[model samples]
Target: MHAHGGTRSGDAVPGDEELLARLRAAPVLAGPLPEFDPAAAPDSPGPLFAAWLTDALEAGVPEPQTMTLSTADADGEPSARVLILRGIDSADCAFVFASDARARKGRDLAANARAALTWYWPAHGRQIRMAGPVTALGEDAVRRDFLGRSEAARAAAFTGTVSEPLTGTQEYDRAFRAARALVAAEPDRVPDTHTVYRLRAREAEFFQGRADPFHTRVRYVREGRAWTRTLLWP
Candidate 1:
Protein backbone atom coordinates (compact mmCIF):
# COMPACT_ATOMS: atom_id res chain seq x y z
CA MET A 1 0.00 0.00 0.00
CA HIS A 2 1.12 3.55 -0.71
CA ALA A 3 2.27 5.47 2.38
CA HIS A 4 0.85 8.77 3.63
CA GLY A 5 2.04 11.88 1.73
CA GLY A 6 2.65 9.80 -1.34
CA THR A 7 3.31 11.64 -4.57
CA ARG A 8 0.83 11.66 -7.40
CA SER A 9 3.23 9.51 -9.42
CA GLY A 10 2.86 6.80 -6.68
CA ASP A 11 6.56 6.66 -5.89
CA ALA A 12 7.40 5.51 -2.33
CA VAL A 13 9.04 8.09 -0.06
CA PRO A 14 12.74 7.69 0.65
CA GLY A 15 12.58 7.63 4.47
CA ASP A 16 9.12 6.11 5.01
CA GLU A 17 10.36 2.58 5.68
CA GLU A 18 13.07 3.76 8.07
CA LEU A 19 10.60 5.92 9.98
CA LEU A 20 8.03 3.11 10.18
CA ALA A 21 10.63 0.62 11.40
CA ARG A 22 11.74 3.02 14.15
CA LEU A 23 8.14 3.54 15.24
CA ARG A 24 7.49 -0.17 15.30
CA ALA A 25 10.59 -0.74 17.42
CA ALA A 26 9.54 1.82 20.00
CA PRO A 27 9.08 0.43 23.55
CA VAL A 28 5.54 -0.45 24.61
CA LEU A 29 4.44 -0.06 28.24
CA ALA A 30 1.86 -2.75 28.99
CA GLY A 31 2.98 -4.75 31.98
CA PRO A 32 3.09 -4.69 35.75
CA LEU A 33 5.38 -2.02 37.21
CA PRO A 34 8.96 -2.95 37.93
CA GLU A 35 9.94 -3.60 41.56
CA PHE A 36 11.52 -0.32 42.66
CA ASP A 37 11.53 0.20 46.39
CA PRO A 38 12.38 3.77 47.39
CA ALA A 39 13.58 2.56 50.77
CA ALA A 40 16.17 0.43 48.95
CA ALA A 41 17.58 3.45 47.12
CA PRO A 42 20.54 5.21 48.66
CA ASP A 43 19.48 7.59 51.41
CA SER A 44 21.45 10.36 49.72
CA PRO A 45 21.45 11.40 46.07
CA GLY A 46 25.24 11.71 45.90
CA PRO A 47 25.86 8.09 46.77
CA LEU A 48 23.07 6.98 44.46
CA PHE A 49 24.74 8.96 41.68
CA ALA A 50 28.06 7.34 42.47
CA ALA A 51 26.53 3.86 42.23
CA TRP A 52 24.90 4.63 38.90
CA LEU A 53 28.08 6.24 37.58
CA THR A 54 29.98 3.09 38.42
CA ASP A 55 27.42 1.08 36.49
CA ALA A 56 27.90 3.34 33.47
CA LEU A 57 31.66 2.88 33.64
CA GLU A 58 31.44 -0.91 33.96
CA ALA A 59 29.04 -0.95 31.03
CA GLY A 60 31.69 0.86 28.95
CA VAL A 61 29.68 3.95 28.20
CA PRO A 62 31.72 6.61 26.39
CA GLU A 63 32.46 9.93 28.12
CA PRO A 64 30.54 8.95 31.22
CA GLN A 65 31.26 12.27 32.88
CA THR A 66 29.91 14.34 29.97
CA MET A 67 26.87 16.38 31.04
CA THR A 68 24.80 19.32 29.87
CA LEU A 69 24.99 22.45 32.05
CA SER A 70 22.09 24.92 31.83
CA THR A 71 22.40 28.47 33.10
CA ALA A 72 20.51 31.73 32.80
CA ASP A 73 21.34 35.43 32.97
CA ALA A 74 19.82 37.93 35.40
CA ASP A 75 17.73 39.17 32.48
CA GLY A 76 16.32 35.61 32.11
CA GLU A 77 18.10 34.68 28.88
CA PRO A 78 18.64 30.91 29.13
CA SER A 79 21.82 29.26 27.87
CA ALA A 80 23.03 25.67 27.87
CA ARG A 81 26.22 23.91 26.82
CA VAL A 82 27.91 20.57 27.31
CA LEU A 83 30.67 20.50 29.89
CA ILE A 84 32.83 17.86 31.52
CA LEU A 85 31.96 16.80 35.08
CA ARG A 86 35.18 17.23 37.01
CA GLY A 87 34.33 16.39 40.61
CA ILE A 88 31.52 15.68 43.07
CA ASP A 89 31.17 15.89 46.82
CA SER A 90 28.62 15.29 49.55
CA ALA A 91 28.67 18.96 50.48
CA ASP A 92 28.48 20.07 46.84
CA CYS A 93 26.84 18.41 43.88
CA ALA A 94 29.27 18.52 40.92
CA PHE A 95 32.17 20.52 39.53
CA VAL A 96 32.62 21.67 35.92
CA PHE A 97 35.59 23.37 34.30
CA ALA A 98 34.87 26.88 33.05
CA SER A 99 36.34 30.35 33.02
CA ASP A 100 34.31 32.69 35.20
CA ALA A 101 34.98 35.88 33.21
CA ARG A 102 35.40 34.40 29.74
CA ALA A 103 32.13 33.01 28.39
CA ARG A 104 28.43 33.69 28.48
CA LYS A 105 27.81 30.73 30.80
CA GLY A 106 30.29 32.10 33.29
CA ARG A 107 28.77 35.56 33.12
CA ASP A 108 25.34 34.07 33.67
CA LEU A 109 26.55 32.14 36.70
CA ALA A 110 28.06 35.28 38.14
CA ALA A 111 24.78 37.13 37.68
CA ASN A 112 22.66 34.19 38.87
CA ALA A 113 24.02 31.35 40.97
CA ARG A 114 21.33 28.86 39.93
CA ALA A 115 22.26 26.12 37.41
CA ALA A 116 21.14 22.71 36.21
CA LEU A 117 23.04 19.69 34.90
CA THR A 118 21.78 16.72 32.95
CA TRP A 119 23.76 13.50 32.44
CA TYR A 120 22.48 11.01 29.91
CA TRP A 121 23.96 7.56 29.20
CA PRO A 122 22.12 6.29 26.16
CA ALA A 123 23.93 2.95 26.19
CA HIS A 124 22.51 2.12 29.62
CA GLY A 125 19.29 4.04 29.05
CA ARG A 126 19.82 6.04 32.24
CA GLN A 127 19.76 9.76 32.96
CA ILE A 128 20.48 12.05 35.89
CA ARG A 129 19.33 15.65 36.35
CA MET A 130 20.77 18.00 38.94
CA ALA A 131 19.97 21.59 39.91
CA GLY A 132 21.74 23.84 42.36
CA PRO A 133 23.58 27.08 43.03
CA VAL A 134 27.08 27.57 41.60
CA THR A 135 30.17 28.83 43.45
CA ALA A 136 33.42 29.85 41.73
CA LEU A 137 36.71 28.37 42.83
CA GLY A 138 39.48 30.58 44.19
CA GLU A 139 42.59 31.49 42.23
CA ASP A 140 44.68 28.92 44.08
CA ALA A 141 42.38 26.09 42.98
CA VAL A 142 42.46 27.29 39.38
CA ARG A 143 46.27 27.42 39.45
CA ARG A 144 46.53 23.93 40.89
CA ASP A 145 44.30 22.52 38.20
CA PHE A 146 46.16 24.48 35.54
CA LEU A 147 49.53 23.14 36.70
CA GLY A 148 48.23 19.59 36.53
CA ARG A 149 47.36 20.02 32.87
CA SER A 150 49.84 19.09 30.16
CA GLU A 151 51.83 21.81 28.46
CA ALA A 152 49.70 21.58 25.32
CA ALA A 153 46.48 21.89 27.30
CA ARG A 154 47.91 24.73 29.35
CA ALA A 155 48.95 26.49 26.15
CA ALA A 156 45.38 26.24 24.90
CA ALA A 157 44.21 28.10 28.00
CA PHE A 158 46.86 30.81 27.46
CA THR A 159 45.21 31.55 24.13
CA GLY A 160 43.16 34.38 25.62
CA THR A 161 40.56 34.48 22.89
CA VAL A 162 37.52 32.58 24.20
CA SER A 163 33.97 32.55 22.83
CA GLU A 164 35.01 35.15 20.27
CA PRO A 165 34.20 34.97 16.61
CA LEU A 166 37.04 33.50 14.56
CA THR A 167 37.79 34.15 10.90
CA GLY A 168 40.66 31.93 9.83
CA THR A 169 43.44 29.59 10.95
CA GLN A 170 46.12 32.31 10.69
CA GLU A 171 44.25 34.56 13.11
CA TYR A 172 43.85 31.70 15.58
CA ASP A 173 47.55 30.94 15.48
CA ARG A 174 48.42 34.59 15.99
CA ALA A 175 46.17 34.75 19.06
CA PHE A 176 47.65 31.54 20.46
CA ARG A 177 51.18 32.92 20.10
CA ALA A 178 50.21 36.13 21.90
CA ALA A 179 48.66 34.13 24.73
CA ARG A 180 51.74 31.93 25.04
CA ALA A 181 53.96 34.97 25.25
CA LEU A 182 51.83 36.39 28.03
CA VAL A 183 52.06 33.12 29.95
CA ALA A 184 55.81 32.91 29.44
CA ALA A 185 56.36 36.39 30.88
CA GLU A 186 54.48 35.53 34.09
CA PRO A 187 53.79 31.89 34.72
CA ASP A 188 52.40 32.49 38.20
CA ARG A 189 49.80 34.95 37.05
CA VAL A 190 46.37 33.34 36.89
CA PRO A 191 44.45 34.43 33.83
CA ASP A 192 41.27 36.23 34.82
CA THR A 193 39.43 34.03 32.31
CA HIS A 194 40.44 30.73 33.93
CA THR A 195 38.07 29.65 36.68
CA VAL A 196 36.10 26.62 37.81
CA TYR A 197 32.54 26.61 39.08
CA ARG A 198 31.10 24.02 41.42
CA LEU A 199 27.40 23.30 41.65
CA ARG A 200 25.96 22.83 45.10
CA ALA A 201 22.99 20.62 44.32
CA ARG A 202 19.74 21.44 46.07
CA GLU A 203 17.70 18.97 44.05
CA ALA A 204 18.37 15.96 41.80
CA GLU A 205 16.44 13.34 39.89
CA PHE A 206 17.55 9.93 38.59
CA PHE A 207 15.80 8.21 35.73
CA GLN A 208 16.17 4.56 34.73
CA GLY A 209 14.72 3.45 31.41
CA ARG A 210 13.27 -0.05 31.32
CA ALA A 211 12.25 -2.42 28.59
CA ASP A 212 8.88 -2.66 30.32
CA PRO A 213 6.35 0.15 30.13
CA PHE A 214 6.94 1.60 33.61
CA HIS A 215 10.18 3.52 33.97
CA THR A 216 11.59 4.59 37.36
CA ARG A 217 12.17 8.15 38.55
CA VAL A 218 13.42 9.25 41.96
CA ARG A 219 13.72 12.83 43.12
CA TYR A 220 15.64 14.42 45.97
CA VAL A 221 14.88 17.90 47.18
CA ARG A 222 16.44 20.16 49.76
CA GLU A 223 14.01 21.35 52.42
CA GLY A 224 14.86 23.59 55.38
CA ARG A 225 18.57 23.03 54.77
CA ALA A 226 18.04 19.25 54.61
CA TRP A 227 17.54 16.96 51.64
CA THR A 228 14.43 14.80 51.35
CA ARG A 229 14.13 11.95 48.82
CA THR A 230 10.92 10.87 47.08
CA LEU A 231 9.87 8.65 44.16
CA LEU A 232 7.89 9.93 41.19
CA TRP A 233 5.86 8.11 38.54
CA PRO A 234 7.47 8.01 35.12
Candidate 2:
Protein backbone atom coordinates (compact mmCIF):
# COMPACT_ATOMS: atom_id res chain seq x y z
CA MET A 1 0.00 0.00 0.00
CA HIS A 2 2.98 2.29 0.75
CA ALA A 3 6.38 2.67 -0.88
CA HIS A 4 9.53 2.51 1.20
CA GLY A 5 12.40 5.01 1.14
CA GLY A 6 14.55 4.92 -2.04
CA THR A 7 11.73 3.01 -3.79
CA ARG A 8 9.65 4.63 -6.49
CA SER A 9 5.90 4.70 -5.97
CA GLY A 10 5.50 2.81 -9.25
CA ASP A 11 7.72 0.06 -7.89
CA ALA A 12 4.96 -1.05 -5.55
CA VAL A 13 3.29 -3.98 -7.31
CA PRO A 14 -0.43 -4.34 -6.74
CA GLY A 15 -2.82 -7.29 -6.85
CA ASP A 16 -4.69 -8.04 -10.08
CA GLU A 17 -7.77 -6.01 -9.19
CA GLU A 18 -5.68 -3.21 -7.66
CA LEU A 19 -3.50 -3.13 -10.79
CA LEU A 20 -6.55 -2.76 -13.01
CA ALA A 21 -7.97 -0.08 -10.68
CA ARG A 22 -4.67 1.82 -10.70
CA LEU A 23 -4.53 1.67 -14.47
CA ARG A 24 -8.11 2.92 -14.70
CA ALA A 25 -7.36 5.73 -12.27
CA ALA A 26 -4.34 6.91 -14.21
CA PRO A 27 -4.92 10.13 -16.11
CA VAL A 28 -4.69 10.23 -19.90
CA LEU A 29 -4.95 13.18 -22.30
CA ALA A 30 -4.70 15.49 -19.31
CA GLY A 31 -3.08 18.02 -21.52
CA PRO A 32 -3.17 21.46 -23.02
CA LEU A 33 -3.24 19.35 -26.18
CA PRO A 34 -2.80 20.72 -29.66
CA GLU A 35 -5.78 20.78 -31.99
CA PHE A 36 -5.80 18.61 -35.12
CA ASP A 37 -8.21 19.54 -37.91
CA PRO A 38 -8.38 16.61 -40.27
CA ALA A 39 -10.26 18.66 -42.87
CA ALA A 40 -7.33 21.04 -43.20
CA ALA A 41 -4.66 18.34 -43.27
CA PRO A 42 -2.17 18.17 -46.14
CA ASP A 43 -2.97 16.17 -49.24
CA SER A 44 -0.08 13.78 -48.57
CA PRO A 45 0.92 12.05 -45.36
CA GLY A 46 4.50 13.37 -45.59
CA PRO A 47 3.58 17.01 -45.03
CA LEU A 48 1.14 16.13 -42.25
CA PHE A 49 3.75 13.93 -40.56
CA ALA A 50 6.31 16.72 -40.81
CA ALA A 51 3.84 19.13 -39.24
CA TRP A 52 3.08 16.74 -36.37
CA LEU A 53 6.78 16.10 -35.78
CA THR A 54 7.40 19.83 -35.69
CA ASP A 55 4.57 20.22 -33.19
CA ALA A 56 6.05 17.54 -30.96
CA LEU A 57 9.46 19.21 -31.08
CA GLU A 58 8.03 22.67 -30.35
CA ALA A 59 6.04 21.19 -27.43
CA GLY A 60 9.27 19.93 -25.83
CA VAL A 61 8.55 16.22 -26.12
CA PRO A 62 11.67 14.28 -25.19
CA GLU A 63 13.14 12.26 -28.05
CA PRO A 64 10.40 13.43 -30.35
CA GLN A 65 12.06 11.76 -33.33
CA THR A 66 12.20 8.37 -31.66
CA MET A 67 9.86 5.70 -33.08
CA THR A 68 9.04 2.03 -32.80
CA LEU A 69 10.30 0.18 -35.89
CA SER A 70 8.50 -3.10 -36.45
CA THR A 71 9.58 -5.91 -38.74
CA ALA A 72 8.64 -9.51 -39.33
CA ASP A 73 10.83 -12.50 -39.99
CA ALA A 74 10.46 -14.89 -42.91
CA ASP A 75 8.05 -16.94 -40.82
CA GLY A 76 5.93 -13.87 -39.88
CA GLU A 77 7.38 -13.58 -36.36
CA PRO A 78 7.10 -9.93 -35.42
CA SER A 79 9.89 -7.88 -33.87
CA ALA A 80 9.93 -4.29 -32.65
CA ARG A 81 12.59 -1.94 -31.35
CA VAL A 82 12.95 1.72 -30.50
CA LEU A 83 15.36 3.77 -32.58
CA ILE A 84 16.12 7.37 -33.35
CA LEU A 85 14.84 8.54 -36.75
CA ARG A 86 17.66 9.22 -39.19
CA GLY A 87 16.05 12.03 -41.25
CA ILE A 88 13.33 11.36 -43.81
CA ASP A 89 14.13 11.25 -47.49
CA SER A 90 12.62 14.29 -49.19
CA ALA A 91 12.79 13.01 -52.77
CA ASP A 92 10.89 9.75 -52.24
CA CYS A 93 9.12 10.66 -48.96
CA ALA A 94 10.41 7.60 -47.13
CA PHE A 95 11.25 7.37 -43.43
CA VAL A 96 14.89 6.58 -42.76
CA PHE A 97 16.74 4.61 -40.08
CA ALA A 98 19.91 2.58 -39.92
CA SER A 99 21.27 -0.56 -38.30
CA ASP A 100 23.71 -3.40 -38.72
CA ALA A 101 22.77 -5.42 -41.77
CA ARG A 102 23.44 -8.62 -39.81
CA ALA A 103 21.08 -7.68 -36.95
CA ARG A 104 17.83 -9.59 -36.47
CA LYS A 105 15.70 -6.69 -37.73
CA GLY A 106 17.92 -6.25 -40.75
CA ARG A 107 17.66 -9.94 -41.60
CA ASP A 108 13.93 -9.72 -41.10
CA LEU A 109 13.72 -6.89 -43.62
CA ALA A 110 15.85 -8.86 -45.99
CA ALA A 111 13.42 -11.75 -45.87
CA ASN A 112 10.17 -9.76 -45.67
CA ALA A 113 10.64 -6.29 -47.13
CA ARG A 114 7.56 -4.92 -45.36
CA ALA A 115 7.69 -3.09 -42.01
CA ALA A 116 5.94 -0.45 -39.92
CA LEU A 117 6.91 2.58 -37.85
CA THR A 118 4.92 4.07 -34.98
CA TRP A 119 5.50 7.37 -33.22
CA TYR A 120 3.75 8.35 -30.00
CA TRP A 121 4.06 11.62 -28.11
CA PRO A 122 1.85 11.18 -25.08
CA ALA A 123 2.47 14.79 -24.06
CA HIS A 124 0.54 15.88 -27.13
CA GLY A 125 -1.92 12.94 -27.11
CA ARG A 126 -0.76 12.06 -30.64
CA GLN A 127 0.18 8.83 -32.36
CA ILE A 128 1.23 8.28 -35.99
CA ARG A 129 1.52 4.92 -37.68
CA MET A 130 3.06 4.13 -41.08
CA ALA A 131 3.36 0.74 -42.71
CA GLY A 132 4.83 -0.38 -46.05
CA PRO A 133 7.78 -1.89 -47.88
CA VAL A 134 11.40 -1.20 -46.86
CA THR A 135 14.48 -0.83 -49.01
CA ALA A 136 18.17 -0.49 -48.23
CA LEU A 137 19.90 2.67 -49.35
CA GLY A 138 23.00 2.75 -51.48
CA GLU A 139 26.48 2.23 -50.01
CA ASP A 140 27.32 5.88 -50.49
CA ALA A 141 24.39 6.95 -48.35
CA VAL A 142 25.18 4.32 -45.73
CA ARG A 143 28.83 5.34 -45.51
CA ARG A 144 27.97 9.02 -45.32
CA ASP A 145 25.57 8.46 -42.43
CA PHE A 146 27.97 6.18 -40.61
CA LEU A 147 30.80 8.66 -40.91
CA GLY A 148 28.58 11.45 -39.65
CA ARG A 149 27.91 9.65 -36.37
CA SER A 150 29.85 10.40 -33.19
CA GLU A 151 33.07 8.56 -32.49
CA ALA A 152 31.49 6.47 -29.78
CA ALA A 153 28.64 5.51 -32.08
CA ARG A 154 31.07 4.60 -34.84
CA ALA A 155 33.08 2.51 -32.38
CA ALA A 156 29.96 0.67 -31.27
CA ALA A 157 29.03 0.05 -34.88
CA PHE A 158 32.47 -1.37 -35.47
CA THR A 159 31.94 -3.94 -32.71
CA GLY A 160 29.80 -6.04 -35.12
CA THR A 161 28.18 -9.44 -34.45
CA VAL A 162 24.96 -7.86 -33.28
CA SER A 163 22.26 -10.19 -31.84
CA GLU A 164 24.85 -12.83 -31.06
CA PRO A 165 25.04 -14.22 -27.53
CA LEU A 166 27.88 -12.62 -25.63
CA THR A 167 30.01 -14.94 -23.54
CA GLY A 168 30.61 -12.23 -20.96
CA THR A 169 31.19 -8.53 -20.40
CA GLN A 170 34.89 -9.22 -20.72
CA GLU A 171 34.42 -10.23 -24.31
CA TYR A 172 32.41 -7.08 -24.98
CA ASP A 173 34.99 -4.88 -23.28
CA ARG A 174 37.79 -6.36 -25.37
CA ALA A 175 35.87 -6.00 -28.62
CA PHE A 176 34.76 -2.48 -27.79
CA ARG A 177 38.24 -1.40 -26.82
CA ALA A 178 39.62 -2.73 -30.10
CA ALA A 179 36.81 -1.10 -32.00
CA ARG A 180 37.41 2.23 -30.33
CA ALA A 181 41.09 2.04 -31.15
CA LEU A 182 40.28 1.22 -34.76
CA VAL A 183 37.93 4.19 -34.97
CA ALA A 184 40.62 6.42 -33.51
CA ALA A 185 43.14 5.23 -36.06
CA GLU A 186 40.80 5.41 -39.01
CA PRO A 187 38.22 8.08 -38.39
CA ASP A 188 36.55 7.57 -41.74
CA ARG A 189 36.25 3.83 -41.34
CA VAL A 190 32.78 2.31 -41.70
CA PRO A 191 31.74 -1.19 -40.88
CA ASP A 192 30.73 -3.31 -43.85
CA THR A 193 27.54 -4.24 -42.02
CA HIS A 194 26.36 -0.69 -41.45
CA THR A 195 23.22 -0.19 -43.52
CA VAL A 196 20.64 2.52 -44.03
CA TYR A 197 17.05 1.62 -44.82
CA ARG A 198 14.03 3.54 -46.07
CA LEU A 199 10.41 2.61 -45.42
CA ARG A 200 7.99 3.91 -48.06
CA ALA A 201 4.62 4.01 -46.39
CA ARG A 202 1.66 2.77 -48.39
CA GLU A 203 -0.80 3.66 -45.66
CA ALA A 204 -0.36 6.16 -42.81
CA GLU A 205 -2.70 7.08 -39.98
CA PHE A 206 -2.70 9.93 -37.51
CA PHE A 207 -4.54 9.55 -34.21
CA GLN A 208 -5.35 12.34 -31.82
CA GLY A 209 -6.76 11.44 -28.43
CA ARG A 210 -9.43 13.50 -26.64
CA ALA A 211 -10.48 13.10 -23.03
CA ASP A 212 -14.14 13.73 -24.03
CA PRO A 213 -13.99 10.31 -25.79
CA PHE A 214 -14.36 11.69 -29.32
CA HIS A 215 -10.95 10.77 -30.68
CA THR A 216 -9.83 11.88 -34.20
CA ARG A 217 -8.32 9.51 -36.74
CA VAL A 218 -7.24 10.29 -40.29
CA ARG A 219 -5.76 7.84 -42.72
CA TYR A 220 -3.86 8.41 -45.98
CA VAL A 221 -3.80 5.72 -48.60
CA ARG A 222 -1.40 5.91 -51.52
CA GLU A 223 -3.06 5.52 -54.89
CA GLY A 224 -0.63 5.59 -57.82
CA ARG A 225 1.41 8.76 -57.35
CA ALA A 226 -1.32 10.49 -55.36
CA TRP A 227 -2.69 9.94 -51.84
CA THR A 228 -6.32 9.79 -50.73
CA ARG A 229 -7.29 10.94 -47.24
CA THR A 230 -10.16 9.50 -45.25
CA LEU A 231 -11.67 10.42 -41.89
CA LEU A 232 -12.26 7.32 -39.78
CA TRP A 233 -14.66 6.68 -36.90
CA PRO A 234 -13.07 6.73 -33.50
The candidate that achieves the highest TM-score relative to the unseen native structure: 2
TM-score of 2: 0.92
lDDT, candidate 2, at 142:
92
Tens digits of per-residue lDDT, candidate 1, 127-216, equal 899998888888777887676666556667767467778798898799788777776776766666788788878899988777664678
- The models' CA-based lDDT, in order, is 0.77, 0.89
Query: All predictions: root-mean-square deviation over Cα?
Result: 6.8, 2.9
Candidate 2: the clashing residue pairs are none
- Best of the candidates, lDDT: 2
lDDT of 2 by residue, 49-68 (tens): 88888888998999997999
State every prediction's TM-score relative to the real structure: 0.80, 0.92
